[model samples]
Target: MPPPSDGTRHLAPAKVNLTLHVTGRRADGRHDLDSLVAFADLGDVLHVSPGDALTIDGPFANGVPVDDRNLIRRALAAAGTTRAVDLDKRLPHPAGLGGGSSDAAAALRAVGADLGLDALMALGADLPVCLAAAPSRMRGAGERVDPVALPRLHAVLVNPGVAVPTGAVFAALEGHGPPMPDVLPAGDPLDWLGGMRNDLQAPATGVASVIADVLAALTAAGARLSRMSGSGATCFGLFPDPAAAEAAARRLDYPGWWARACTLNPSAP
Candidate 1:
């Protein structure tokens, strides 16, 4: 059955890479990544209605393109469907939060487009996992996504209001690092996660020095573990509990910085 003509709302949660290890570089120039990915409670929202127009509005919607260049449009085209979309762009772009890809995936679901994994991936590397919108292990230039069991986690996400180009960060990578262990530890996820690393963090910090400051602030705010997410300026701090995470988010005082406390692997609404 087709969705009602009024509209349908979809959540586009933020994608957080808790552990990102660059294992190798593929012949196609894409890096092979071994990472544990998760979704946060907070993210953008999309409302899709039956039409062919696309409209965007939200705090971060000022500069986003609305034409065919936008991922939402491309996704609709790829699915052989069209819909009027109103995107509430909450997350900052190019912040390693996978905002655009998540929005694209939401559009596909809104129109009931069942483009398979391969077709979805062709739209973007992160599309597969964003479509799943669940905790998973991602590998091989993001072509592999295996859902994993993960407990709900309290975390604070921060963005330093700076752009770190993905290409520049990858170009700065000194060398590929080893992949994560074949099996994750059975005990505390935080303990195991603390030992893991985001291979792109160093190079990304090099690209934007402010990232180091964000990590330091997160650690100082009593985060159990702190790390940069994806390729850039956004970082996450895992807290012991919701109260601690919320407190830390409140304590992080920096001009022009964005911070919010959220739960990872939260139940779908």
Candidate 2:
């Protein structure tokens, strides 16, 4: 049965890993991770209404699978329900932004899926966190998530039109890095974040040199701190406020690159 024509809208915010540490490799070949995660205010949107087929339309929709392979459809299946989803794919895939996972989590939310965190992790390592859609400390193989308080962050996100494969980046990794301190620092989170690191950034940059350029561009644009998010391609530049982030985003005029100024952990509507 098709969903009602009530036109329910859901926002699937982009997931950003402000600081990611590769802890160790599991016996099963999975790698453990310790990271600070946040969500960007701007991201793909979904509209649920009366229809039979899934439709995708947005600036970044090209090449997105519309078949059963799509995470949204898979999420619906996991929830034992189906609905016509119109996905506005605003974020780029494989850009280290966790766009697909976020979209899947939004579909689950739209249908009010009651799946537990473990079940959500089975869908995707990012599913649990994306479903939470808040600042969190993620550990293990992305299964452990703990909600944390964080100050709103102003940032410019940039993708250099290059897709760095996650597997490739992992294959290029040299070794695991140390995890965050047992207790996060008090006050401004940015100060503590600067001391942490995304262990995948170097390997991802090696897979796609353009990532380095994106980081450099952000730094040159007057960002207080610039670093790669998740695995590769997409990088973030932290600024003092919205005005600074917006200005920095405008200054990043690379052709074919996608850049947006967004607030992480924005106030509820």
Candidate 3:
């Protein structure tokens, strides 16, 4: 893909986990999470214009620091696209969903600026999935992602206006958990995933009890499968259609809470 046009760019949306399980711990003390990662129909939007600086704006902006730790900054540094990169935050950070990673993936791909997906997978496992930006399988500490045809699934993402610290959740984990499945079925991967699970939810829930509450809400709303995404406070529930997910999100409404209807984009939905 080529770089973005002179003034604008766009990012695909993001979603929380419908199920999160921490099956084990790693030698590096990282938890092996077998999460059902999905994308939302709505997410933070980024506008990029090649310039000499970086800027960010929008709601949920108070705490997001502008520094080297900012993934956008790092991505630009890595991609050698030194120009004005403007990010408007639509997603909350550290909410169990990879909002920041998703944002970074969008930014990186927006202009084809950052290190490509291949180089980034070497940086972190989740980075690859973010690059793929589709509903697929993510396993093996995030280093592995394989595209599989997923069942058309709709969901609602809910975050009760709080950020769950991922590092802290991983720190609380007791083991490296479990290994990735050796092979997944070749068709309708979502059906196959009904048998798969996230290995990190228990430990993550221990650290952020809201995660449990969120899942409960999802379940109460008639979600077929509800789980916390990544290591988070954001929870999602899978449903049969957009109407179902939207209805569930409606009945579970909280004014200050972050919520949206999301359909698993089999390809970057």
Candidate 4:
């Protein structure tokens, strides 16, 4: 059955990369990466109505573009249909949280169109996994998304309100590092995660120094594992449980910083 005539609403969950490995650069000048991806309950909201317009409003709406340049618009174009889209922009822009790409994914899904793989990739490298909205292994500059059953995790996401362009971070990278093992070690997820790394962290830090500070704060607040997500200005702290993650987030009183506790793998049956 098709969705209601009025349209459908979808959640654009935050996409987090637990580990990111820059394998190498391609001849086309695009970098190849291998990343373990998971989604958080925290994110923006998109509502699609039977019309051909887009309206964006919410706390972080001002930070995003509303025109064709906006990823949502591009996604709608890719889906080959026009719908009245109301985006409740909650996530910070360019925080390394994949907010825009996730929103675009949600929009494309809500349109109920069959935009093939090639079309989706043209929107953004991260759009494919965001469309899956599940724990997955992302490879080949984000074309391959293989679903994995990841344990639910309690995490606190922190962004220092700095926008680090993806291009600049890649430019700052010294060189490609060793890729992670094909299959992560079988053990406690947190332990396995600690042994991995976001290769872009150092270069990203050079672009946004506050990323290091965010990691330190998460650690001081008792996070078991704290690290930058993707080519970040945003980082995450993994906790033992939800209560602990919430408490840690509440204790963070940094001015001009955004922090929130949310659960990973929160999809409903």
Candidate 5:
């Protein structure tokens, strides 16, 4: 059955890579990565209506071209829907927040009921887990997922007002980069994440080293763990408590960088 109203609203959360180890580059131009993925209690809002066309709107709608290249459009097109897709912007773009991925997931499961997580999995990696809206380990070309128990973590996300293109960052590696860890540490998630790593950090740092500076600054601010997500620019620091995390965020002096303090989401069902 078609959706009752013009559309159904859904919340799409930004993602934090608790651990991202880019262990190796594969033969088919794909990067081999092992990442511990977690969702934030905070994210953008999406309203998907079954209709005749696609559209997007919000307060932060600048520069987000409503074109065929946009992930939401691609997702709706892939799902073979003509829905009027409206996305209220919240998460930073290309700052490694996984905004596009999350948006695509929303369009699929929330908007197009005919397609589910498994169906979208074949469309794009990260879509399935993103639809799940929980923390999971994504591995083997981003196909494998292990949904693990994660604690409610407090964190601050800092993004220098720069859009770091994922392709460019990966291309900058020139097919040469560090590899993902063969085995992650076994312990409490906080402890494990504290020791976790991001494989794309180096190339991302090379493209825009300010990300490295952000990591340093967050570490100086008493962050237990700090690392870049997805590709570049946007970095996160995990603290023990919400108060402590917000306190640290308030002290950051990156006037041009976008920052936010949000609690880490407990795993979703």
Candidate 6:
């Protein structure tokens, strides 16, 4: 609120979909989904200062749009803040990680907007969970968000530099959907997540074959469990701890592939 006291920084953590079960298709072509989402410690950063301009800089900032098309711009406009926003982009774009949405959510909270759920949904399907910045069960095209406590996860994220369009993957899907269980089985996070899967993975692999390679590398490098997140091309592996996850990432050295070890933020209230 009030530009976060000016010059304050906010985190835009990477959104990881541990489980995404595509259910049914709506009349408008929107797909219904049930997903369990968590935020990663590794992600982009945003800084706010007293001004109206928006500036972006980071390793992955070269081709990101900076105008109204950018979610941050729209978010700031929606929040009615003119704070000079500087985004430090770290996560790879179109990598199945909701980087932009997370950044926008951070901007909204920074501006102290009290918009309702419907308003936030207008920003993006992932915006609500990103705004909460916590582990939650997301359903019905992301309109329903219920925060849930989850054990911390040590994970390695890998992107093969290929952007997989979400629409294409969905279009390539063969079946209607396999509905996810209403209640998630509780236990160790890794074990529970290992049994679940991203329904989009098969179709997404058809779009980007390299995604298969990414998953293979992760598994071969000693990952207990590995799968693609969200849509495609950016896969993740769950390890026992940060050290193991980091070690697995380092071992899977592929030229031009982006890989990092991060802990999933424990459930936030």
Best by lDDT: 1
Candidates in order have lDDT scores of: 0.90, 0.88, 0.69, 0.87, 0.75, 0.85
RMSD of each: 2.7, 3.1, 3.3, 2.6, 3.9, 2.5
Which ranges of candidate 2 are over 4 A from the true structure? 1-7
Q: On residues 155-261, what C-alpha lDDT tens digit does candidate 2 reach at each position?
A: 99999999888999999999888888978878777788889999999999889999889999999998888999999789999999899999988889679999999
Query: How do the residues 1-269 of candidate 5 rate in per-residue lDDT, one tens digit apiece?
Result: 01223347777788888777777777888878788788887777777665745566675567676888777777777777767767888876766877877877777667544565556666667776686667777887777777766667889998888878788788876443454455555655567566556767888888887888999989999998888888868899988888988988888846787788987774333
- Per-candidate clashes, comma-separated: 0, 0, 29, 0, 5, 0
Clashes of 4: 0
TM-score each candidate. Answer: 0.95, 0.95, 0.84, 0.95, 0.85, 0.94
The runs of at least 3 residues in candidate 5 whose Cα sits more than 4 Å from the true structure, single-residue gaps closed, are 1-7, 112-123, 174-187, 267-269
lDDT tens digits by residue: candidate 6, 1-269: 11232447888889999899888889988889989988887788899778878889999998889889999888878877667889999999988899989999888887787768887889899988888888889999888989877778889999999999998999998776665666766766677777787999999999989989999999998888899999977998988877998898888757899999988864322
Ranking by TM-score: 1, 2, 4, 6, 5, 3
**Which pairs of residues have clashing backbones in candidate 5?**
7-49, 22-179, 22-180, 23-179, 23-180
What is the TM-score of candidate 1?
0.95
lDDT of 5: 0.75
User: What lDDT score is found at residue 190 in candidate 5?
Assistant: 64
Q: Is candidate 3 or candidate 6 better by lDDT?
A: 6
Comparing candidate 1 with candidate 4, which one achieves the higher lDDT? Answer: 1
Can you write out model 4's per-residue Cα lDDT over 1-269, one digit (the tens) per residue? 11222447688898999999999999999888989999998798888888988899998989588889999889888777788889999998888989998888887778766778798899889988988888999988899989886888999999999999888999988888777787766668898888888999999999888888999999999999999998888899999988999999988758999899999886522
Residue 60 lDDT, candidate 2, scale 0-100: 90
Q: For residues 81-155, what per-residue lDDT tens digits would candidate 1 score against the true structure? A: 889999999998889999999999888878778988888888899999888889999999898999888888999
Q: Give candidate 6 misplaced runs (Cα > 4 Å).
A: 1-7, 266-269
